[model samples]
Every structure is written in structure tokens, then in C-alpha cells.
Target: MVILFNKPFGVLSQFTPEAGHKALDEFGFPAGVYAAGRLDHDSEGALLLTDNGPLIKKLLDPKFGHPRTYLAQVEGQITEEAIKKLSSGVEIKGYRTKPCIAEMATEPENLWPRTPPVRFRANIPTSWVRLTLTEGKNRQVRHMTAAVGFPTLRLIRTKIGNIPLEGLQPGQWRFVQEKVI
Candidate 1:
């Protein structure tokens, strides 16, 4: 079985516990499943979980090129040129990123507010962007946008591969049957 979860901000991606934080128990998952890829404790949104090891590998492996989409709220005004650069590729921490989709999103309607909301600065305007990456690198979206000069203020994953966080709220989950491609 495959599960698509809308992980809330500040939640660990693992079933394991960390000090001063909650675990999968707090999110309410049935025993025996594990996360396919991690979303940082500070970041939020769509995370996949399963008991099937091979399916997990195929989804998490970079070679499979499964697209994971995020809605990133960035600090400062972003230019169209910068969006193009992100779509093309950007060198972050010495390695270049694979080409990905980056576009401005209309203020995300019906987005559930994050617990302990992202920091806001009176001086800097924030823009919402939709970013899709096939590779699951450590903190990649945060690093990529920062490298491009518009630092990400908040990040949310809305979709993973063909599954979306539709109808799910933070800390909620639903069981889905695997789609045979």
C-alpha cells in the first residue's frame, strides 16, 4: 500500500523520534510503513510512505526522475529572468541542479496555515512560486532559491509524482493503492 501524507511544518520525516519533537505517533500512521523521502523538520508538504521497499527506492532514487513539486514562498521580488535560471539549472554548494520547473503561483488558495508561521519581515515582500524537482537532495529547494538570490521563506510540497495532497489536512493521512505504470 502507498500513502500520500501532507506533513505539517516542524514534523520530522522519519518514524523515529527526535528530542523536543513529536514522531509518527503524533501524525497517526498505522505501524509498518516508512517515509519514502524526507522533508526537513522546518519544511512542510507531500510525503510518500510505504511498506514496499522497491517502490520506495524507485520513488526516492534520482534515476527514476519522479517529479516532486513544491510551493516556495520567497523573500524579495523575483524577476522573470531568475525564474528562467531556476528552470534551467543553478549551481548550489558546488554541484549543479537538474533542470526543473519554476513559476510564480497565484497566492495559494485554501492553503492551511502553518503552525508557528514563517517569519515575516516588514521590509521584504514575499512571492509564491511553484517548483518541481526530480531529485531528492538535502534541502535542495531551500539551497537552490538561496543560490539564485531569492531566499525561500517557506516551502510546501503539494504533489509527489502523480499523487497530490488533495483533501488532506496537516497531520492527516489517507491510504492509496499503488498505481501500476
Candidate 2:
């Protein structure tokens, strides 16, 4: 069985708890299913779980280049130059990212309010960016935005490949068709 889960902020991707953090077990996913990929504890959005080992390999392998789409709220107004830099790839932590689609995005309608909330700054402005990346790196989005002079204040994965984080609130999950994979 394949499951598409809407992971919430502050939740760990694994089933086992760690460092006092809430893990995927809290969601009550079925037995034998394991996460195909992970979202960070501080990040939120679509995560896939499955019992099929080969499916996990297909999703996590970098060469397969499964696209993961994210919506990031970054500090400062994002600029065209920054978008170009993101689209063309940027050096971060001694490695350069692969070029991917990066564009300005309006805040999504019907967005759920994050618990604890993103901090607000009176003097600084924030803007949204839509990024679709084929590679998954540790804190890559946050690192990329900071490298481009726009630090990410909030991050959410809106889609994984063709499956979207739609019709589900944080902590909600549903079985998905394997054909979509």
C-alpha cells in the first residue's frame, strides 16, 4: 500500500521518536509502510510512505530526479535576480545545486496556519517563492535561500512528483494510487 501523508511542522519523518520529537507513529500509518523520503522536523507538507521497497528506491534515488515542489516564505522581497540565480543554480556548502524551476508565487489560498507561527518582523518584508527541485539535500531550500540573500522563514512541500498535498490538513493522510508514482 502507498500512502500520501500531509506532514505537519515539528513532526519527525520516521516512525521512531527521537529527541522528544513527535514521529510518524502518531499519525497511525499502517503496519509495514515506511516513508519513501523525509521532510525535516521544521518543514511541512507532502510525504509518501509505502511497503514497496523498490518504490522507495525509485523516489529517493537522485538519478531518478523525482521533482519535489515547495513554497517558501523568505525574508525580504524576492528579486528577479534572485530568481535567476535560483533557476541557474547557486553554490551552497561547497556544492552547486542543479538548475530547477523557481518563480514568485502568491500565498496559497486556504493555507493552514502553522502552530507557534512564523515570527514577524516590522522592519523586514517577506515574499513567497515556488521552487521545484529534482534533488533532495539536507536543508537545501533553507540553505539556498540564505545563499541568495533571502533567508527562508517558512517552508512547505506542496507536491511530490505529480501527487499534491491537496484536500488534506496537517496530520491527515490517505492511500494513493501506485500508478501516480
Candidate 3:
């Protein structure tokens, strides 16, 4: 079975335990299923988990280059130059990212309010940017935005490959077809 979970903010990607945080069990899934790709504790979005060996194998294989799309709320007034830089790929943590698509995105009208909301600065502004990348790296989205001079205040992954969040609330999970991913 392939499971798509809308992992909540501050939740660990793995079903394992850690201090001061809830794991996947709190959201509940069948035992023995492992996440195909990981979302960091600070990031919220579509997390694919599956028990099907073939599905797992395909997702884990780097050659597939499945796209991961995110709506990132970043600090500062993001400029066209910044978007172009992002599209061209910026170096983060000594690794130069592959070229990808980056475009200005409006704040999602259907977005649910975040608990313990991002800090609001009366002077500074935040803008939404849509980022699509095929490569998954540790804190890559956040790092990439920071490298472009607009630190990410919030990051939400909306899709993994062709599967989208599709109105799943935080901490919810649903079984999906292999082809949907």
C-alpha cells in the first residue's frame, strides 16, 4: 500500500521516537511501512509512506527524479532577480543545486492557519515562492531560500511527483495508487 500523509509541522518524518515531539504513530499507520521520502521536523507537507517493495524501491531510487513541489513563505520582498537566481540554482552548504523552477506564488487562499504561527515583523514583509525540485536534500528548500537572501519563514510541500496535498489536513493520511505518485 502507498500512503500519502500530510505531515504536520514539528512532526518527525520517521515513525520513531524522539524527545519532546510526536512521531507518526500519533497519526497512525500500519506497522512496517516506511516513508519513501523524509520531510524535516520543521517542514510540513506531503510525505509518502509505503509497504510495497516495488513502490519503495522506485521512490528511493535517485534515477527517477520525482518532483517535489513546495510553497515557501519567505522573509523580505523577493525580487525578480532572486527568483531568477533560484531558478538557476544556488549553492547551499557547499553543494550547488541543479537548475529548477522557481516562481512567485500568491499566498494560498485555502491554507490553514498554522499554530504558533510564524513570527511577524512589523517592518519586514514575506512573499510566497513556488519551488519545484527533483532532488531531495537536507533542509534544501530552507537553505536555498536563505542562500538567495530571503530566509524562509514557512515551507509547505504541496506535491510529490503528480500527487498533491489535495486538501488533506495536518496529520491526516490516505492510501494512494502507485501511479498517482
Model 3 C-alpha RMSD to native: 1.2
Supply the TM-score for candidate 3: 0.95
Tell how far residue 121 is off in model 3, in angstroms: 0.6
Model 2: per-residue lDDT, tens digit, 1-181? 8899999999999999999889999998899999999999999999999999998999888999989999999999999999999999999999999999999999999899999799999999999999999999999999999999999999999999999988999999999975645
TM-score of 1: 0.95
lDDT of 3 by residue, 35-98 (tens): 8878888889899988878877887787887899999999998999999999999999889998
Clashing pairs in 2: none
Q: Which stretches of candidate 3 lie over 4 Å from their true place?
A: 178-181
34 in model 2: Cα distance from truth in Å?
0.4
**Model 1, residue pairs in steric clash:** none
Instruction: List the lowest-lDDT window of 10 residues for candidate 1.
Output: 172-181
Model 2 lDDT, residue 27, Cα: 93
Q: For candidate 3, give the lDDT.
A: 0.89
What is the C-alpha lDDT profile of model 1 across 86-171, one tens digit per residue?
A: 99989988899999999988767788897798788898888888899988789999999998899998898988877888789888
